[model samples]
Target: MHSDPSGSTDRIEKDIVINATRERVWSTLVTFFWVDEGNLGTIDPKAGDRFVAHSAKEGSFPITIEKADHPSLLSYRWASAQEGAEPGEGNSTLVEFTLTERQDGSTLLHVVESGFASLPSAMAERAVSDNTYGWEEQLDALKKSVEG
Candidate 1:
């Protein structure tokens, strides 16, 4: 976990080694929501592409693609649990996925969710705890989705 210099935002990061190629991992990431198999609805994988992710637990939320570099990195900004909230510095967080290919044909998937401290204190703490657990489950699901 890392935080910005002002301590106004905390970053939660997790890494997992998946028994899949980088291409396969990248395809799984940009094409669909890993936590839920729903399509992202015509993602261009370019900056400024807007998409919605539907989760059984979290419902639907908007995401703005911040950066997309094929087979390496994809980042997006999404609102927190607030309903109908727009993604931005106060109400949203940045989610970034970085892929590294290994010599044994496995891919290391790194996920980071940041900007928690920008929310209210209670919300920020809860989000940090919730997202830490959420990412663990999501990463497990990702490994299963690609490996199985």
Candidate 2:
């Protein structure tokens, strides 16, 4: 088990090691599992790029990519699913992925989701809980995606 944040988690994070290299994990994060658009549009094996996540859900705002550190880290702002941007409104949240290397040469992935503090209290809590669970699922998803 991992250490859970001991407080109001306006932000949440999780980590896991995959049986692969950082380069391979990078590919899976950019071109595969996560959506490609907006911030997640352009990603390379370096810093200073934006990676956005597109939405297939009706009215779900896209996550804006913010920063990256090659095969090590990627950060973005996650948008709200509830605040359906009608005409002009936009919802922005914080999201980040960090990759670490193990002595065994496997890859370790860490994910952090932030900025939900701005959401409505009820919604924020739900988003936190949901994502906490959601990331667990996705961590498994990514693990399988890369290891397979």
Candidate 3:
């Protein structure tokens, strides 16, 4: 978690090591928890693609891809505060996933989500707090899913 002196979170960063190859982790990640997994066959992600990430406990979030580089990096803009709204100029945050493969075939997965400071103060505070917890749980889930 990265925050300013006033304790407002403008960015969130987390990394975890998964006992799996980078390629395997990447495939699982790109397809993780979408309500509609139909189009995610092996999840060959690309820039400009749009999708919704759904969680039964958290509803749906609109996502627009910004970058995708093979099994290494994937980044997107997401409207997490305004659920179901399209991500755009002032309403979204950038979320990036970076993967590094180790010599032992394991993977180091790092995630960074930034741009919350651009949102309304209260909203930014809530979004940052909620997502701070969310990432911890999500990463644990990802590790379990991939390692299995």
Score every model by TM-score: 0.86, 0.73, 0.89
Error of model 3, residue 56, in angstroms: 2.0
- lDDT (10s digit) by residue, model 2, range 10-77: 67878899999998888888763444323343345343333334456433444445676777877765
- Which is the better candidate, 1 or 3, if ranked by lDDT? 3
TM-score of 1: 0.86
lDDT of 1: 0.79
Worst 10 residues of 3 by lDDT: 32-41
Report model 2's TM-score to 2 decimal places: 0.73
List model 3 lDDT by residue over 1-148, tens digit each: 2234456768999999999999999988888543333344555788998878776667778788899998999999998888788998778899999999999999999999999988777778888999898889889988987988
* Number of the predicted model whose lDDT against the real structure is largest: 3
Report lDDT (CA) for all predictions. 0.79, 0.65, 0.84
Tally clashing residue pairs in candidate 2.
Answer: 5
TM-score of 3: 0.89
Per-residue lDDT tens digits of candidate 1, residues 1-148? 3333444448799999999999998887766666445655325599998767777767777788899999899999887556456687777889999999999999999999988867766667767777888899888987888898
Clashing residue pairs, backbone N/CA/C < 3 A, model 3: none
